[model samples]
Target: MTSSSRALLFLLACICWVPVTAGAGERPARIVIDPGHGGVKEGAKGPGALREKEVALQIAHRLRSRLEAAGGEVYLTRERDALVSLTERVEMTNDHGADLFISIHANSMPTPRMRARTEGVETYFLSASASGEAALAVADRENSEAPMSRAARGDSTLALILDDLVRTEAHADSSRLAYAIHPRLVARTRAADRGVQQAPFFVLSGVECPAVLVEVGYISHPEEGLKLGRADYQEKLAEAISEGVLAFLKDTRRRDAARPAQVAGSQTP
Candidate 1:
């Protein structure tokens, strides 16, 4: 098939996956979006002077508008070029009782050679560390600013997973959320698929709701970086991500409705 043919197919698929809205009696889902970095902490910058922080915030706004239109209560961690701590971000997500939380960021490479050679999309859920060196490196960069992120020991991953299970059932749903969002991103953007991964991302450490972090694309790659800076391309990214979240919510609502409701004082079984 031709490149244009494939692009057309993706656009049609996006249109088909119309976002499901809340019914008359159903409460709208709450979503919290965190744009990676801001203020002096501008995230990765690359070709065309594309800055991760700027792109992330722009995408967040687009996503918020899309989700709200689809009957969701959307909240952004930071509305402008301001810095917000990981704790603050998670606090907002939990306080809002968000059904889902998404942190948006752009990836970067350490060297010029690697920058030119690498570019793709990677979606991640909280994990101590997995997917080997690349994921670990990505985690390290994202976690660099989190004061205690570096102190975690190797075995701490398992411990954290167990602890998270007790804290919130969202831990289990997180991977499902990651898988849903990642494939849609790759399909719509036709970007290289780096596959779903997991790492001990400090920002996700405190989230009390289902959460996933998206490394939308490598800002360091010349071609992709220039595209990332474009408003039209950013809108496509937002639209694709919105589709994924809505699909996942649709499934969640179905499962919720299927479960037997508890009586006035009886236990759920």
Candidate 2:
């Protein structure tokens, strides 16, 4: 996809969703966009010296722009290049009372010597424990950016607090967001569909809203790296994400409408 082609796709997607009538009472949706890695924390690297932080931030900005144009209130965890603690990022959104949290990232593998052909987007929700190799791979790369200390590795105090407070309301919502976005991206970009999974991402575990971490593509794969580095692909990535967020809002509204109203019995005599 070229830049012009990607822009056309985004324009078309926007036309499909932009409300035409009765837009009167609709509340503007809010979203928190977290661009993974920053400052000294150069996340995963690609074949051509592309940094995960750089691409993540670019995509995050693109996503923010799209959401804002669609009448959404989007907040960014970090606007400039600076190291932000994972705990702080989640807390920021919690404090802001945002509707959803999305962390953007690119994937990398350890076997740099032997390139395995893996390319796709994977969406994740918080889990107490990650299941198998997929979970392990995610942990390894995410951990690489911020190595865990002994204190950090210790008990489950943080997890317990977050599980009780943060992730409850939005786990299913985040999963649905993931489901909505990943396929659109795959279809539009012709990328592989890694599908959505649950993983205990430390960054997402502490958030209050429905939170998800999106691995946009495999930086480790040479071809994928080239594709992701292109502005065209990034725009497509942004547009697909925007569509998913819209879907989430639409579904939430529908669900709220379908729920029975609570009636008070003889409150006043």
Give each model's whole-structure lDDT. 0.85, 0.79
Candidate whose lDDT is highest: 1
The TM-score obtained by model 2 is 0.83
For model 1, how does the per-residue alpha-carbon lDDT over 164-204 read when each residue is reduced to its tens digit? 55456687789888988999999999999999998878788
Residue pairs with backbone atoms closer than 3 Å in model 2 (clashes)? none
Off by over 4 Å in 1: 1-20, 152-158, 166-168, 264-269
**CA deviation > 4 Å runs, candidate 2:** 1-26, 113-116, 143-167, 264-269
Per-residue lDDT over 47-163 for candidate 2, one digit per residue giving the tens place of the 0 to 100 score: 777988899999999999988877777899999888998878878998988888999999877686634677777877776656567865685567554446424765486457556
Error of 1 at 127 (Å): 1.4
| Highest TM-score scorer | 1
Question: Model 2, residue 12: displacement in angstroms?
Answer: 9.6
